[model samples]
Target: MTSAHPAPSNTVNAPGTLAAANEEFWSNSAETIFNEPWVLDFQAKMRAFLEKNIDWLGIVNDRTSATEGAEKKMLDYACGDGFLTRVYHPFFTKCIGIDIAAGMVKKYNEAAIELGLASEKMYAVKGDFSASVLELPKAEDVASTDLSRDEFFNFDFVGVALALHHMEDPETAIVKMVERLKSGGVFLAIDLLNSEGVSESKDEEGNGGNHHHHHQGGHSHGHGHGHSHGTTATGRSGPAGHTISHDHPAFSIELVKDMFDRAGLTDVDIIYSDWKLELPFVTDPGAKLLVARGRKQ
Candidate 1:
């Protein structure tokens, strides 16, 4: 099968990094990922797609402003600058962002506050979102990190966007995020449409849903602003897009649908749109937005 993000050679990148270094990669690259022009352009397109499909998404769309809501909540898992949560910010009473990268968490809150959103209105926390892996699904599986806190459970929705291909295990990641929802809460996710169709797009994603929210192009530090790496293997020296390479090559509708079904979610529906990504350093195929959602039941 053809790889979704296979880049033509003759490029500059850190070649020896492993998937374990993703946190450091994301931490170091957080500084500029938020404001980079190309990154902003990509996010704008994501916003447009979400807006265009608001009805299909089944989330709030009142544009009520972040300060007004105080009853419901949203979990922005792998939240990078809180894109999905930001779009639904006005409608939800409280929104919490969870990420593996501390810097990404900081950025999510900073951007919200800059837009006049108080910390209580919308906040982000740094946690190992890839938890619940080794241990069986138990009451205490999520107890180690802030993930176990009461404020973390029972959500109106939990949304992940554009970062699934960066996860080490997208399937397990789904199980973890789904456990955080209330009995009837919905799980929303977005990923690339995989230009090669189901068979070619069958490859999994990288670390987990990811901090690659800074990624639309390739991996280095992130978004051309130095936000995607850790420091060599733990830090990036110059303007790079990510600190590491993506282990999970790409995503397809079949793979995601299977994940949702395995997670025991009902009414799963996966859809795609005409939007595409044409960033400077990105050579991966499939630029269209692929959206998927299912209820916890």
Candidate 2:
């Protein structure tokens, strides 16, 4: 098992600081707050969506055959626990899973090894995704790295799954990811959508209210005071609060589309939309997961 302590190789100061301070929250609490059982179910749903919605295999085959005589590379940006990495391993000649959290990288590596994916063809690396500093030896150097002309530039596809929302500025992050792709490369983003806001109302007597109203016909449930709203133990807001050390932002469909468009991408397509059943304590049935794809111009 990997130690919970911060790795010496971590280099992104801000995110690394957040990760150091909140490591326990991310590694341990996530399994509880996010609810592993629910995550398994969501993974099943996502797998089904991939199989029925996108022609992933066909696309891979086409891309692979097209590049038969050359090297092909794909990246699973912010790959957590190697879930999607394992799923999409067959497509690319090389699949590199990069993440800032050492814990995630450790687990991803372990999973790859256990799953017999430890070959040079597929692997995970501990690095800062925002700054793209995989070789830096310390977390503080992430910002100083010059990403404007990095050497690992050639890639056929970059998959960002549930990662954009974790960044402070998703628009900028998406644009940077798009910039890293080769011309005509594919960029896929799979994320969650907040199903608007729904609040509970009290009765005239100030007692537990029974006035049932539906928002878009979705089921309604009573809200409890113990439900911590918009605040984590660290006093920060958003999903970061649930974790021990990092703050991850969430994104919506329109917001993502606008960002992609601004990045000069084309052939944008929303390939999947399915309810991401919330972990037992994090959210309700209102949150929906969305998968969007676009080609680099």
Candidate 3:
């Protein structure tokens, strides 16, 4: 427990859509973005929503109480410092997280260690689903950077939280994430709801990259736009004018359904979260989380 563990430097991206700038932005913003109080409150709301929708999320019972040796596994995409990891912690025997920033990966590992949890039980690897599958890291790189290994495949549950809006292509990202699920596994998306479709798929000036925001200290998950709270988004103190102005509208229900269907998933259903969400992650006003779920049959 006393051993000093360094963040793994081996980074892997699916190959195509992840922008290098955004990746670097997130890496730089990782330190303090997820640390705000409002951000934590927002997270609590999101957690409550997940717990409320436990059955729909495919878990046997809420992990908050009633301990069991559940062997289920989960893949949390854009897992800034392991929010979903904590959310699913009680239900899983193992959980692997993927993020575009190495700094974010370090934060996830640090949090696990702080909780006295073993790395094998809960840990995050630096990678993004938007990369190219063809260029998966070489075999030797699996231990450090490669995400295409046997362990990285076949998750019981897969989720991409608020960060979906940051991807270069949501459709392709969904497909790539679904490929990680085993048969009958569930693929989930928990993001901001914008029935009003995005004017364009461009993510200009919001947190920076991941879940940006104003002055949120909760997980301080600064997508560079940072946490769902805060003046600096997440918590990155970037350049003076480096703020994101929520120009990118959140995902619409129809858009999410179409993505699930196109990815060859079955039994797809979408629901709005009971939490009246807001922030930059930064979040938005009157924001509702659209929780869309599908099973890979």
Candidate 4:
């Protein structure tokens, strides 16, 4: 039952280790970026959309909630500081949050424990999404790394929020993600849209690159151009000469649709487009937030 796609040949500029990037972002200005009241509100709305409309818990029951004794299992891929993880705990019977950053995972675990969600029913783990496969624990099994497609035929759902856009090869990432799902399982994704035709390019330092904005449609709606400056959640400048623009990777949207098709998923639905206003301090003006849902065939 395990399915894998050929490894992607395209090499996007490595953004360094995920942990380093997050640590830099957090230590330097993460509080300013993530602690804003408006940012919190936006996150709450997104979580609500996934929980209420997506029927996330019900989907975990193999998309057959009417069955009386179906056990539910779910994974929150690239789950940041477990912001969404906290919101999802009450809905699903068994939930696991995985993140690439060890620091992020540690913080999430602390939060979960504080919230009394560190019990056996719920947990968080440090995992790499770019890796080929994830070794997850089965419901009844104690501790085993012998996880294969044969042992667990399906996952009720897999969710990636704001995390996919960071990957260099999101298409390959999507293919691998879908292969982990069972028939009728759901994949929910929320990511930034590249409305401004921006591309990633490295500067002289060879540090992680930054996005340069290119005007596409007449959709300009945020701050003016040229080394855009804005306050962070903790009221700090993000990066030198970094503007808040909505320039996502070129293939972001198209790649999602193509992966859905290639994975043999159906009933592909755009649950929420333009869910909330993109943080003005992040990227280009009028940046869009897209939420899509697809069911594996």
Among these predictions, the greatest TM-score belongs to 1
Candidate 1 lDDT by residue in tens digits, 24-102: 7666667866667867777777687677767766665423533455467888987877777767776687888887777
**What stretches of model 1 exceed 4 Å from their correct place?**
1-19, 61-70, 131-145, 198-247, 284-286
Model 2 TM-score, 2 decimals: 0.66
* Residue 160 in model 3: lDDT: 82
lDDT of 3 by residue, 176-294 (tens): 88999888888878765553422111232243321211111122222322122212112222231121122222555455666676677777766665544454333234344567778
Q: What TM-score does structure 3 among the candidates reach? A: 0.71
- Give the CA lDDT, 0 to 100, for residue 143 in model 3: 34
Question: Can you rank all candidates by TM-score, best first?
Answer: 1, 3, 2, 4
Candidate 4 structure quality by residue, lDDT tens digits, 1-297: 000001121233334343334434433542344566766777766666556654522354443542445656566766656665566555455666665555455565666677776456566665444534443645563322233434223566777776654454455567766777767777777664444212221121143222222212222222232211221111113341121111222223344555556556666654323243545344344344546677777
Give the local distance difference test score of model 4.
Answer: 0.48
RMSD of each: 11.0, 10.9, 11.2, 12.2
Flag the better candidate by TM-score, 1 or 4: 1
Better of 1 and 4 by lDDT: 1
RMSD of 3: 11.2
What's the lDDT for residue 81 in model 1? 75
Residue 285 error, candidate 4, Å: 5.0
